[model samples]
Target: MTIRFDGQVALVTGAGAGLGRAYALDLAARGAKVVVNDLGGDPHGQGENRAAAQKVVDEIKAAGGEGVPNFDSVSSYDGGFNMVKTAIDTYGRLDVVICNAGILRDVAFHNMSEEDWDKVFAVHLKGSFTVLRAAWPVFRQQSYGRVMLTTSSSGIWGQFGQANYGAAKTGMLGLMNVLKQEGVKYNTMVNTVAPVAGTRLTASVMPQEMVDKLKPEFVSPAVVYMVSNECSTSGYVIEAGAGNFSRASMVKGPGAQPGMAANLDAEWVQANWDRICSLEGAVPMWRAGQTLAAFQAANAKQA
Candidate 1:
């Protein structure tokens, strides 16, 4: 079956180039009225221009797709509100939002400055919050919405010299997880995408050949599906790039139960270290309170 967004509106931040551009183009081609938002800032989040975003809008227009340029920084609350307002005012409704705006401040943990760390959060983490919060009420009233947050491998599994960026990226998952539960009844799905595309953000870190292969085009397909009505799952982290797609998750180990032991201490944990850390029967919890069952089951089995 063909996936189409006909009559729906979408907002893609950082749509001036790379992954965001790919997403906006793809969505527009598939019949969505797209809002191509770009701060047009440098990799370090300095400076801005309206040309980059307008160029993408021009491309969409040339291709006979509907799109409008939105030059706004996602780092502030007002910017976020205006971005969504632009969609609603022009298209009358917004069904999707791809939070792809971010900045890079790569430095070792010891050398990373407070300004660098805070700025990274301002764009990647808080930016997601700002935009999503602006659209939350609309989704609730309409009872339908799709939200895609851009995460990274550095945040999921960690990487060298990206302490600040990694921290901000990983923090998005926490927000996604909570929103998934809250949005369930309203049919608002929240998901994360950890892309390994060769955007300007990765140009410096990756080899030429590898970067050439991992174009943003390859990653945009999975992202489009994530925001489309075709997707049924939520609270999932999908890793995509170079025509490969996979699901990533957080799991809990079935640890040894400390049942009825009133005097448990660090020594007991030390004694059962192997059993506590074993992944043999580890499983992913579907929700926040589900982990308590592991203790109950272990105690019951022990009894």
Candidate 2:
């Protein structure tokens, strides 16, 4: 295959099943040594099973692919470090990491408890972060690495009974954003995907017909490409599922900005509310300095 991994090693979190399993198999089939990590937890982030990870590893080996099983949780720093350590100890180095481990605790904001909130955040947001922290050093030393964070439409848009889930999932985007920024210099790139499929997590909400249409393999392309050498994108949130792929972006529109000497009061905000939310022209992705420059340009003539 032209898209061969050759001698590379890929670490896939939650690889016991679902999209992570798909990714692990695909990479291994393409010649990568895979590290399959799974805490073997329930959809609510409870329980464990060494067999979940072991089974996937066995399958990879049976298919002529090299892989190791890891049962460490990603929510804690030590666990994340141990997972990475396993890859390094077994294969010498890592070329990719798909932080796809997650749990769902669906509840309205009013009814969501602190435990639910913390658990979701622990597995999806901080979990991804902890893994990256472990992998960053190895990536920098090698000067190459691919990272993909799993997000969701519920997190991207909105959904009832997903206050905890949405908050945690969306935070992955923020983590990817900063990782993208920091990784630019070190060549350790990071990106995100909001996937839809018939995983154990989504089997209840998504209809079976739709699930059949949106196979986990269809979502694998986005992950494979993003975590491959060919993909140069970072700080991006792409959506893929059911054989359709699209991108998500943060956009900024030119808004009504009063000059330096102009009043900065509720009246000003009230009057310019329309301008504030307008989207007539295409919006641009503005960086921190760019926003400052826009501010200066807007008030330049006034000064």
Instruction: State the lDDT of candidate 2 residue by residue for 1-303, as single tens digits.
Output: 677788899999999998999999999999999999999988898899899999999999999999999999999899999989999999999989999998888877899899998999899888898888999999999989899999999888979999888878888877877788788888887989898887888888888787666679988988888888888888788899877899987778877777878768888899889999887774746256788888898889677
CA-lDDT, candidates in order: 0.93, 0.88
Misplaced by over 4 Å in model 2 are 284-286
Q: Over the stretch 1-303, how does candidate 1's per-residue lDDT look in tens digits?
A: 399999999999999998999999999999999999999989999999999899999999999999988998999999999999999999999999999998899998999999999999999999998899999999999999999999999999999999999989999899999999999999999999999888788989898888888899999999999999999899999999988999998888877777875568899889899998998877777687777776678778778
Q: For each candidate, C-alpha RMSD in Å?
A: 1.5, 1.4
Query: Looking at model 2, how many pairs of residues clash?
Result: 0
* TM-score of every model versus the real structure: 0.96, 0.96
In angstroms, give how far residue 106 of model 2 lies from its true place: 0.6
Model 1, poorest ten-residue lDDT window?
Answer: 254-263
User: What is model 2's C-alpha RMSD?
Assistant: 1.4
